[model samples]
Target: MSFLKRPNDFLFRTLVIVASVSLATLSLLVIYSVVMRYVFSDAPDFVEPIALLLVIVIAMFGAALKVREGGHIGLDSLVNKLPPRGQLVATAFQHGCLIVFAIALFFGCLQMVEATMEDRIPIIGLPESLRYCVPVIASVCIAMFSLENLLALFAQKQK
Candidate 1:
């Protein structure tokens, strides 16, 4: 219980909260948009565009959320077949690959955000900045998860 007070715990919680809230809010708005479109005469002009953008954010951040939560599915059948010591090595290798992937997400997102400045969404004519939010949010979450994973690796070594 006391371990929950540690800095790593704080960071993990923050990432989960951010990703979940954003996705939930977006989901709600999408439902509302559907209702309004069907029950009312015309769809809100911006509804589709806004919803589309938000949906991207939801999906991207939600991926990181899954990873951080350990809800991301693992191909453990093969690893489980290995001997105990082999399993440890495999797990460490997996985490290392994940860290690299996270780093790629963070940097790749930054590049996207910059390169999309001149791009625009077809319907909304909104600058691609709105679309880039997906990657930005994902990058942040992945970075956070990677940091947490690093700490966990070290903790395991210590134990």
Candidate 2:
């Protein structure tokens, strides 16, 4: 558990940094695109696809980070109203659901990646599958984070 803690901390920090950078970059890119389109009347063709990629990065990474922090939307008020054991059960169930969803997302993204590997995004010449790959990575992180939460929940229960 201690070993997992170190790696999980590292991963959380890394995701935070990645998501922050992606958001900042996306904002600047959009601003630049707007400026170029309205002021210069010469918006770069690559901006749209690049922005789309950045958006995926920001969204997927942000969602994973939120899960680790327990910041995502939830029925927390109802769970909190339960007795200790019931709260534990509810929390574990939530984590289990997240794990299931993440696993499904991962496999679905893998299929998309495989199916679209040969297709390229217009103006960027990058594989169309690159878009789905971000979600695959995020899904793995989501699963790991959910598992970590479940483990922590049971450990605390043992006390």
Candidate 3:
């Protein structure tokens, strides 16, 4: 049933919501930080790190959502020129590469977080590993999306 795609749909919707909220929060935080710095001559030291975290969350989640939506940039015109089977092959290959890249990013971030667990952000006292967590989560989302697309492609082929 079409409901089989619910997980990917859920993830895409969740990422979109999270990214939208994070972007709005980031904008407000930036404005507050600027006002505090220029008007009050006092900006909270924690604001910078918090904004950075929000930025990472917004960017990565947005990117993963774009991947899920097939909104990422590509040479689609070239792919479209191929025959139907060729198009399917090209699309599958593209998503397969995405899966591999996402897997690599996941482990890379994992190692980075492990290496930085001892370090803390001076302002917020948060573990430096927190900086890398967005990438890890985004990578998981990207991998899931790509895997779903790949499976769907194969299913189409079978049909």
Candidate 4:
């Protein structure tokens, strides 16, 4: 088994389940909202904001898990054709870029959360900062995964 797999098994599986269930719930919420609006001429005020939150949860956590699995979409056709050393260089570059991006995103999310702490969603009155939670959490996960891959790359070279 790969070195990274065991370490993340529990968290990764939990994230997968959460992302899947959230997406399913989002779909149902939207359907119910549409039906209520058309049939009753009124819909629950919570539906739209909750759906928006679910979208962020689904997208961010799912993307983070994909990063953990090293399965995030990439342009690999040219990289695959490179010689072994060239491929290593390309992969290291990619991981480096990912690490930088993840760190930047994490901090950006933090700032957003801080700035929005007092703001509230119109319907639920939940703090607007809650929306940034997914990005903040997912960015940390992405950064860790990228750093692990970077370390593994160097470890392989040493061996």
Q: Which is the better candidate, 1 or 3, if ranked by TM-score?
A: 3
lDDT (tens digit, per residue) of candidate 2 on 1-159: 676778889989999999899889988999999999999999899998999999999999999999999887679999999998899898899999999999999999999999999999998999999999999999999999999988999888888
Enumerate residue pairs that collide in model 4. Answer: none
What TM-score would each prediction reach against the true structure?
0.76, 0.96, 0.90, 0.89
After the best TM-score superposition of candidate 4, give how far the Cα of residue 72 lies from its true spot, in angstroms: 1.5
Determine the backbone clash count of candidate 3: 0
Error of 3 at 109 (Å): 0.5
All candidates' lDDT scores? 0.70, 0.93, 0.88, 0.88
1-159, model 4: which lDDT tens digit per residue?
Answer: 266656667668888899999999999999999999999999888998999999999999988888877887766999899999998898899888888999999999999999999999898899999999789988988887777777888889888
> In model 3, what are the clashing residue pairs, if there are any?
none
For model 3, how does the per-residue alpha-carbon lDDT over 1-159 read when each residue is reduced to its tens digit? Answer: 255478878878888888999999999999999999999999888888899899899888987988887876667999999999899989988998898999999999999999999999987899999989889999999998888777878987889
Candidate 4 deviant stretches above 4 angstroms = 1-7, 156-159
Q: For residue 17, what is the lDDT in candidate 2?
A: 92
Question: Any idea what lDDT model 3 has?
Answer: 0.88
Candidates 3 and 4 compared by TM-score, better number: 3
lDDT of 2: 0.93
Task: Identify the candidate with maximal TM-score.
Answer: 2
